[model samples]
Target: MNSDGANDMNLAALLRAGADDELQPDQKAHLDAHLRDHPRDTDRIEFERQLKEACGRVMGPISAPPALRERLIASLDRIAQDNSPRQEASSTAPAPESVRLAQGVESLSEQTRRQSFWNRMTPAVRALAAAILLLVGGLFLLQVVNVGSGNLSLAQAHMSEIATFVGDEHDRCVIDPSRAAKFNISELDAAPALLEEIVGKSISPANLAFGGLAFRDGGRCHVPGKGDSVHLRFDVVDQPGETVSLFIQRVADESDELFESGKSYELQSDNQGRAVFGWAADGLNYFLVAKDEALCESYSIERGLTPNAG
Candidate 1:
């Protein structure tokens, strides 16, 4: 290859490594120098950044079910085993220094012979293999989840989006109590009516306040990408720092529908640390997010929305 062609290849490899967050400090310096010379490549980097952000928005918030998670873990292990070297090398054959540098592998000849199988695979081959694995794993996950079965359906994705949004708000307020408006127990009487005016559902705070939970504070909050929602926080009576959040939002809006109407769903958690138990009542969707899974179940049962154990 000509010098320009070789430089193009090197730049491409560096860009890919940077996108994957696998670039070493020296490789990053190299990428920085190349980009300074070729400003036009900035568009490619921007495209990669946008694509990664979009994927995270869509997939990162959703937590896989335990069964599907285990299956994927097992599949990954099997792939690693399959890719493992089958025999000891008779001689120390060194990979090209450029390849070693790009891969962030040691340049020493002995280290080259002991390089990880994944590090040895070309980027093209690794990408193709990853795509194939994702395709198969996605299909397997779909089968395991049994979509459209009325139980835990595809709607969970939408639910997860909402849960993640609320969970983040919950975390922010808890970490910095000053960010949260203090809840007056006296206002509990009018809070339901206020929520009803906005969300069209009136819930009795007495019913939700249980397990040493006392009303802390609440106010209007917005789900980042979706729309408006109402937030209510409760302090675990004896536990100083522990809190729970109750969220009320329209079941469906012009843009997105959170839960299927007339269907009962169970408690679940997004990728966030909190567990979320949600139900649709009247025209509003109610979500209870707490750190304790037992609290989620308790809240669901309190609402008499827990599905049968069958």
Candidate 2:
């Protein structure tokens, strides 16, 4: 090919690699130099980012079904057997013994010997093997799916599902304080800084503390498929028994219709009678939950989370 044509192909390849985040540091430097000469290529970088985000939204995350999980386990077992040293040696040996054994273990002694391998395994060894298999399965499953924040879109989510998580977290931390240690509870004074560090934004107490409730404790909690989030527990100054929880999660897209600015959505009450309300602001999703719906609504209004509050 001509020299100009070759340079064109190289530039195209570099642009694609850079866009996909596969470029080495040296190659990225080259791309930077090229962008200086041809600023138009910068548009390609933006286009690729948008394309990747769009694809993630469309594909979502994939989880293995029970059937698929079983199949994966079986496949892994077969692979392990195929790669085993015993199988390798047997493959090179005379075919007659292997074929005969496959057809039938000719004697009771042969069957007993085959069973001896398992019989010799200690409980600890067997447990270790089982753990290895489970770890392998989990790693394989992760590779087959995208597990990003974009996987859960608040606009399409059922309020019941989100509210259920909020309610459960509240019960665990506020109602049943004995179990709060599981969440790695933080001191009241350090909770705001912890929330800011985790959520990547400064969330002052003024934003979450309201309605005569004072911060009692805060901690991290997992929201199942969504991810880990910070939950701040608040107790009424006068009525110590009355408590509320505010959950803060960093969202992939704060522009979701469900998160329209200054508006709160009331969620379905969980079986435990917790009232849940949620809103999104500044790239963070907030959930306010309490035993009394009136208390939750009052807090939402106080925080300017309700549409009419403004």
In candidate 1, where is summed lDDT lowest over 10 consecutive residues? Answer: 140-149
TM-score list, all predictions = 0.45, 0.44
| Tens-digit per-residue lDDT, 1-310, candidate 1 | 2344334456676776667666766667788888899988877887887898999999888777785576457544432332233211222565464332322211111221232334544676456445544544422210001132124322444554465456666776777666566433335666676666656666675654665678776777775334456788888776688888887776455344544543323333332256666666555667778876545544544443322111
Q: What's model 2's TM-score?
A: 0.44
In the range 88-121, model 2's lDDT, one tens digit per residue, is 5557654464443322212211222232222444
TM-score of 1: 0.45
For residue 179, give model 2's deviation from the true position in Å: 2.6
**Candidate 1 clashing pairs, residues 3+ apart or interchain:** 183-217
Question: What lDDT does candidate 2 reach at residue 262?
Answer: 58
